[model samples]
Target chain A: MRIVALAGGIGGARFLRGLLAVTPSSEITVIGNTGDDISLYGLRVCPDLDTVMYTLGGGINEEQGWGRQKESYVVKEELAAYGVEPQWFGLGDRDFATHIVRTQMIDAGYPLSAVTEALCARWEPGVRLIPMSDDRTETHVVISDEQGRRAVHFQEWWVRLRASVPAEQIILVGADEAKPAPGVLQAIADADVVILPPSNPVVSIGTILQIKGIREALEAKTVVGVSPIVGGAPVRGMADACLTAIGVDTTAQAVLELYGSPLMDGWLVAEEDAGTALDGVLVEARPLIMHDVESAGAIAQAALDLATEIAARRGTAPQGEDAR
Target chain B: MRIVALAGGIGGARFLRGLLAVTPSSEITVIGNTGDDISLYGLRVCPDLDTVMYTLGGGINEEQGWGRQKESYVVKEELAAYGVEPQWFGLGDRDFATHIVRTQMIDAGYPLSAVTEALCARWEPGVRLIPMSDDRTETHVVISDEQGRRAVHFQEWWVRLRASVPAEQIILVGADEAKPAPGVLQAIADADVVILPPSNPVVSIGTILQIKGIREALEAKTVVGVSPIVGGAPVRGMADACLTAIGVDTTAQAVLELYGSPLMDGWLVAEEDAGTALDGVLVEARPLIMHDVESAGAIAQAALDLATEIAARRGTAPQGEDAR
Candidate 1:
């Protein structure tokens, strides 16, 4: 089946790794969330896209789950030496090259979509990895600081503040005017199963949905979303912070309800959130923590199985697709 | 005492190391030429500045005069994966970070001079290294190619073509309208002596002179120049090709004459070309080959001593003041 997975960083990359192992990579298209993308030292850095790319390309340091392994921090040191702003996110000497190339290409008139494609050609992530849009859609977190209430860049709120402050607003700036990247909507429409990994529901998955027509495309398909919340807490990262900002409690039920039955035909939660169920949606609980490649594969297989079973029950048959 | 020394690449870097060893660094200011500067993957790359910086900051590759040692090519490999243009100039992964920071800073409203200062903060090349100007002054060479009478970037002409095709004309684009970088005129005007390194006479030091007021400043000072031409050939690089392009013989006398007595108080050549003096310029020919650190230091000391003697002859006078 043609599998299209929408993803974020860390959790998203780990889950995608399992998804790739579970099926043939050729059949996959990962529409990576770029809302957290930032321009540092003039270079475009898509943390989520890089996470996915590095994870699949075998360049990832399993321990770090972020930058390249054995990474040198010469660039960051030089940047610091220059007294640059936002000295939180560490761009290493080796990693800086990727951002540099991406930034240079973007400056040379290539949009993020084209640049991502160009970057992915080297990693050959097996699955086609694309940004949700070429538009400059940045996720800014509004926090009350001593100065006043203001929105900081996603990274500033993330790395600098460590997301300690209550998120006054989780704004996906530029999404109102943004269009989904080419083939994004089409992939969602043609997907036998549209899977949302346990990525941050607000800033990650939510950011993708904010892109025009993506939610509608998923709504039209046998969409399945894996809950980021397990046992009333995110498996990793600050997912709950965004959840609370949107007036949703950090619960499996609350998150699923936010996605709603209209957008999801199947909702999979961790086995620990056992009592949860949806009236019209197929609910299957499994051990959803992507602790390792095999565990992630099992979770991915379960999501695919849920979609397959739902498609079979509806008396609808999905086309055979690549597993990548 | 005032000291001026010529330089190019690792040899120049080595020589500069010796110059720093022998002289007070606070008074030193480098007038680096941008003729060898190239745009690799859309990011501006200045080789001379990097050489000077890396050497001074103790980051220079002891083996390779150019580029960092233990560098990775993942970035270049990845760039090729995107089918990026300008594959001739080598930009290693570590080397790339330098360019990226510069490009980013420059794009973010920092002038080239300011960007150089920012970069120098990291490398801390003892001397204040100033570019000819902040303007995009590119060196292009007119040559007979496949189509005949075409102009190519200085890099392509120097590196890729290897200057095989005879150059018909050499022009510094934007030189006419370009002003000297900040502190450049002041450094030159206030200097007791200015030395042109044994760099390419036409491209390296020659390009620096092309900037407005640089030649005038040099003419107004006790200026000294070292010839790249040695033993009827260039000391290093394709200086002979550059010389042929400009219709000059590859000889120390020719290069000294090319610079002319109007701008020269002293001229230093390799021992093979020693004792060849001009009408009004003091000449010294010494062993200029930088075999090792010791020899390089010796060469630097020789250049400095020459400038000191010239300064003494000029009565250690300040500019705009009567020696009487």
Candidate 2:
């Protein structure tokens, strides 16, 4: 079936790898979150996009779930020697080439969407990967420490600080003005089902929804979301910290309520959170640990099965087998 | 003695290492040629400035005469994988950091001179390293191949083509509007003796002279030049190809004549070209091969001695000892 998946970094990328394993490559379109994109040392680094690309293209470091396989840190060490700042964000030698090509293209006046497509040409990431928006949309987190309150870039908050400080607020700085990247709205319109992979609800899928028209498009479609919050904690990443920033409890039902029934047609919670109920959405409990590719594939299959069931209850023809 | 030296890339950097061996670190100011500077993958690569810095800072690959020692090519290999052009120019992993820092500073609105100074802060190359100009000044060589006569970037001709195709003309593209970088003119004016190292006379020292006021400043000073040419051939590099393009014979006397009596106060030729003469300029013969640091130092000493003799003949007090 034609599917559109919204993704963030490692967690999201890993989920997509599972989704790709079970689904036909030609049917998947990934809308990668660029809110965490940062210009490091004058090169545009789209961590989420690169993670998805590398993971699917067989270049990802499987153990780390991010960066290139067989990566070298010679470039990082040299930058440190020069006393360049932001030393915490490690960009490997092989990974640096991706940013260099991307930055060079962007500097030559191509928009982020075009640059993303150009970069994907090399990896052939299997699925069509489009950024959430062509425009700059940075997710900044407001944190208060002993020093005082300040807003830092999402990467700084995530990678540098490790989300240690409690986030007072999560702001999508340019989301209000962002237009969905070319092919994003069309992909949503054409898809049989839209999947929200186990990416960050606050910064990844949530940020993609913040872009104008994306949420409205999903509201008109059959959407199934896998709970990034497996039980009372995140399946991966600092999603608990993020959910807390938005004043949401760290539970599958609480997250489903946050997305709301109007947007989510089906919600897949983990077996641990079994019997959790949502008012209008179809809630199913499934194994969501995603310990391996096979487990991830099963999770993806469960979400698709739930979407098919939802379609049948509404007396609409399911596009699953026929579309495939 | 207080000395100001004009330099190019490998050969010039090697000569400076020798000059530094014989001279006090605090007394030398190096005006490095920036005409060979190129922006690759959006990062500024200053070949001449980097060679000088790396050589003096103990980071240079002695065997190659350029780039960092024990460098990795992971970045370059990755760039090629992405199908980025200009693959022949090798920028090592360690060297990429310098460009990254420089490009970052430039993008943040710092002038090239300021960026150069900031980069030098990390290297502590000892001598004050100043680029010939803060403005963009590229050397382009006019060559005719099967594709017909066209001017290409100096690097394309020198590196990719290996200077095999005869250059009909050599043009310093932006030199007419270029101003000498901060401290270049002041260094020349405040010097005891200005030395021209055994750098490429055409592209290296010649490009610096093409800057608006540098040649005039040197004309008013006690200038001494060591011949890059020895026994009717360049000691290193493709200086002969460059000289032939400009219609100058690859001989010490011809090169001295090209600089002319008005600009050059003293000239040092190799023992093989001992009888080579230039009217109105003091000519001295010496063993000019810079096989090692010790030999380079001896050559530097000979240039200073020639400057002393020229000062004594003109009944002017030499600034060498007093400035030292």
Could you give the interface RMSD of candidate 2 in angstroms? 0.6
Give fnat, all candidates: 0.51, 0.98
| DockQ of each two-chain model | 0.43, 0.93
Check candidate 1 and list the clashing pairs: A1-A321, A24-A323, A24-A324, A25-A324, A26-A324, A27-A322, A27-A324, B6-B196, B6-B197, B7-B197
Q: Which residue runs does candidate 1 get wrong by more than 4 Å?
A: A22-26, A69-74, A81-85, A145-148, A321-324, B1-16, B68-74, B77-88, B92-94, B143-149, B161-168, B285-324
Model 1, B159: alpha-carbon shift in Å?
3.5
Question: Tens-digit lDDT track for model 2 on B1-324?
Answer: 688999999988888888888876438899999999999998999999999999999999999999999999999999999999879999999999999999999999999999999989988988999999999999999999999989999999999999999999999998889999888889889988999998999999999999999999999999999999999999998999999999999999899988887899999999999998877789999899989999998888888888888888898856645332
Score each candidate by Cα lDDT: 0.81, 0.90
Off by over 4 Å in 2: A320-324, B320-324
Looking at model 2, the pairs that clash are none
lDDT, candidate 2, A1-324, per-residue tens: 789899998988888888888876438999999999999999999999999999888899999989999999999999998899889999999999999999999999999989988888989988999999999989999999877999999889898999999999999998878999999999999998989988888899889989999999999999999998876999878999999999999898888888887899999998899887877789898788988888888888888888888898898855756332
Q: How much does each candidate deviate from the true structure in C-alpha RMSD?
A: 3.7, 1.3
> Which interface RMSD values do the candidates have, in the order shown?
3.0, 0.6
Candidate 1 Cα deviation (angstroms), residue A267: 1.1
